[model samples]
Target chain A: MAFTLDEAQRIVSIALNHGRDAGWNPLSAVVLDAGGHPIAFARSDGASPGRYAIAEAKAYGAIMLGMGGRAQMARAEAQAYFMGTVNGVFGGKVLPVPGGVLVRDLDGAVIGAVGVTGDSSDNDAEAACAGITAVGYTPEP
Target chain B: MAFTLDEAQRIVSIALNHGRDAGWNPLSAVVLDAGGHPIAFARSDGASPGRYAIAEAKAYGAIMLGMGGRAQMARAEAQAYFMGTVNGVFGGKVLPVPGGVLVRDLDGAVIGAVGVTGDSSDNDAEAACAGITAVGYTPEP
Candidate 1:
């Protein structure tokens, strides 16, 4: 089944709250279906205005690559030219950052992705992982 | 208060359902906050792949111009040069069409905008108005 709107909102809520509870900066989170289209999004109070787009782009990247942002970063680092070409094809939607995480269903099929931004990349990734777990999905990364 | 994610999704849900109930084509809807940043989005099943970006651009046009897409289209038709300049300024984010409607709070302050795409422009505008009304917000045009 596709990632439902309720699930997407739950993911965003969990991620943003996790970042707040951890004393990180205000965070923005986006959930995208497997097709790389946004399902839901939220920007926590006080988050920078730009965080919304960044988070959505990160999630889009994860779904487009069928992998987490951390893994994508590693791959891009090893194949810079190929990655640049891929980025151009996506109109720069792919962000090789730590905050984007792939979400898989119980059968281990990638269903969607969660992207968090606002704090350090590591903290953003941590929040995304927390959200994925809260939603009973595997977080790839 | 900013446009919350919940409200954005609610708007999308209502708009999509309205389109479906009317037996229109599958649609994509996007909600942008007052600052013209996307807060949430959804693409209905069977919608053309291009609807998402078009919906976003329509909403961006509505918010940036502080008017509904229909009004913007009217103005654009009257002043093609000025409309071209505006489009250049926004890097083509502005789409002068009937599908984008401004959202306002009870106090009549602009809070966000919603755009619907996939059907005829008139049908899209009707769907957007239904969505805004469903979310207890004013739908301008």
Candidate 2:
């Protein structure tokens, strides 16, 4: 299941549309390929200056660690050392604590991730989740 | 003097051409603004898989530390803490060990820097310096 750039762009566009309709201010939506590298992103006009980087970092963590925000926020779900090393591999780009959604194939193979920033962390997470679902992909529980 | 995006691209293109003329493999080159953030980058086909991150790191470090290749490599450098923190900040994305050329404006203001990777570290630094100089900017002494 190749993740086409078009598909990636769709994820951001739809996510941005949702943000607009949801009464959120400007937002940045990001899409990462299976390898957790950036494929596409959009930064709306009113988004915070920090939105772009944080969005990419959160998406990188979610996809690379193969977990959702809720699970990561759970008690002792992952070791700090391991998460730290993963962060190192991502070159300071992985924000493992959530606010992103990992998209998976029908058979449960991880394919991509979506991330949002600008709204509250919870809203950012929801927006990314919405993008994942909109693409007809199951997100991590 | 702020680094314009166009000048950054020119730095990368000149650096890359130097590598190409020397029969080096295709490489990745990056330039970062004064704030140690990426302004522009270019990766030729056949570049190393992780060259992008390396290039960014080098650019970031050079601009942040205000050092050139060999001098930036000094073991006794004072910014080691800042360098280490940068590692934590970017999760290994701020490799503060040189291989980049710091850029200065007419007033000697540190405007930006350029980095190249995908060859020997020496070659990478050399190419980056050559490129920055070609763009009519001073590389650190």
- Identify the candidate with maximal DockQ: 1
- Candidate 2 TM-score to native: 0.54
Model 1 C-alpha lDDT per residue in residues A1-141, reported as the tens digit of each score: 567766777788888889889899988888887777776677776676687678877888888888898988898889988768887888888888799999877787779888899999889999999988887787985
Model 2, CA-based lDDT: 0.70
Query: Which window of ten consecutive residues has the lowest lDDT sum in model 2 chain A?
Result: A69-78
lDDT string, candidate 2, A19-105, tens digits: 889998766777777776655556664454466578878887777678765565552255767666767887877766556777778
For residues B36-109, what per-residue lDDT tens digits would candidate 2 score against the true structure? 66554566655544666788777777766677655656632666775577567665666655567777888878
lDDT of each: 0.84, 0.70
Lowest-sum lDDT 10-residue window in model 1 chain B: B43-52
| TM-score against native, each model | 0.78, 0.54
